[model samples]
Target: MRFYGFFRSSSSYRCRIAFNLKGIRPEFVPINLRRNEHRDAAFLAKNPQGLLPALEVDGAVLTQSLAIIEWLDETQPGLRLLPEDATKRAQVRAFAQIIACEIHPLQNLRVLNFVKENYDQDRNGADDWARHWIAEGLTACEAIAARHVRNGTFTFGDQPGLADICLIPQMFSADRFGLDTALYPRLREIRAACEALPAFADAHPARQPDVQ
Candidate 1:
């Protein structure tokens, strides 16, 4: 398996966490988003969407971080990212979606670039846009996790799962934007617990090979 990703991409970070948890080490291929390598013809042939975190396994390429994660959960039987019980799985999925769907899309590189180009927003303006959406989404995420989190260590259960995989990267991004984590105690607590794990620590942006 070969993983194509950018070091600081939240979507790529999420997949890296899942890979560590599953104990699968794919060949790491850095796609330099800053240099527009993700848009190269070769990369577009693999995933026309031109997104980072595309995984090639057995001659098949998988795109979309969430889809790739769910594929991993299904194909790899050892560690389950999603719960077996239908209701619990739904709850976990919902928590993960709050970050993946509601928050991340607005703050991703393409969106930020779009705002900067069309609206004449500077770096500070782009960051403010990211923070606004992230804070709103995280507030709702905290509420949902508070209701459903079974253990203090993770978003869904005592062990890390899909929700934790999603939450930790979002927290990292939140910190990057100078968002005060104190605003969400439960989210911060869960993030702290995740940071203590080798899997999460190993997947951190600073630890990536592509970091300068």
Candidate 2:
């Protein structure tokens, strides 16, 4: 298997975490998003969306980080990223959606670039926009995590799963924007727990080979 990704992309980071946790080490193929490598003909053939974190397995390409992560979870059944029960799995997906769908979309590189280009805003203004949306969305996530927390370490259970996979990368972005995480104590605690694990730590953007 070959995984194409950019080091700083949150979506790519999510895939890395899931792969590590599941003990699956696909060959890392770096795609330089900064240089628009993702837009090249070679990459677009693999992922028409021109996104980072595309997985190639057995000559098949898989795009979209969440979809790829779920595919990994399904293929490797032993280490469950989602709970076995139907309702619980839905709840975990909802928790992940808070970050993946609501928060992340508003703050990803493309959206930030769009805001800067269309609004004539400088980098600082674009960053402020990202910070505002991330704060609002994570405030909601904190409450949602509070309701479902069981093991006191993870968002849903004792072991890190899909929810934690989503949260950690968002928190990394939050720190990049200097967003105060003190308001979300439970989320912070869960992040700390995740960081303690080698799987999560090893997947960090700073640790990636392409990091400058």
Candidate 3:
């Protein structure tokens, strides 16, 4: 398997954490997002979406971080990324989607870049945009998780799973944009617990092989 990703991509970071948790090591193919390599024809042939963290397994290419991670959970052995109960699994998926589907797409590189380019927004303006949406989505996530009957060092359970996999990367992005995480206590706590583990720590952006 060949993993196409960028060092600082949050989506790629999520996949990296999943790979570490699954105990599988695939060949690394670095596509520099900063250099616009993802838009290139060759890379697009593999993933027309031209997103980071496209996993080439066997003869097929898998795109989207959440989809790829879910595939890994279903196929790989080890800790389950979602709960066994269908309802509980849906809750975990909701938490993950709050970050992936809601929060991430807004502050993602492409969207933010478009905001800056077309809207003529400065770094401060763009960051302000990112912070506003991140805070909104995170606040929703915190409220939803609080309503759950979950008690653990990690989100949704005693062990880090899908929620933590999605949360950690989003928290990293929040920190990058200088958002105050103290507003979301559960999330901050979960981030701390997740980062302490070797799987999460080793997959950090700073620890990636393609760090620039």
In model 2, where do residues sit more than 4 Å from their true spots? none
Ranking by TM-score: 2, 1, 3
lDDT agreement of model 1 with the native:
0.92
The C-alpha lDDT values of all candidates are 0.92, 0.92, 0.90
lDDT of 1 by residue, 1-212 (tens): 99999889999999999999999999999999999998999999988988778999998999999999999999985689999999989988988999999999999888999999999999999999999999999999989878765655688878899999999999999999988888898888888889999999999999999996
Residue 4, model 3: lDDT of 97
Q: Write the per-residue lDDT of candidate 2 for residues 123-167, one digit (tens) a residue.
A: 999999999999999999999988867655799988889999999
**Looking at candidate 3, what is the lDDT of residue 65?**
91
* Residue 109 displacement in candidate 3 (angstroms): 1.5
How accurate locally is residue 7 in candidate 1, as Cα lDDT from 0 to 100?
88
Model 2 is weakest, by summed lDDT over 10 consecutive residues, at 144-153
Off by over 4 Å in 1: 149-152
Q: Give lDDT: candidate 1, residue 61.
A: 92
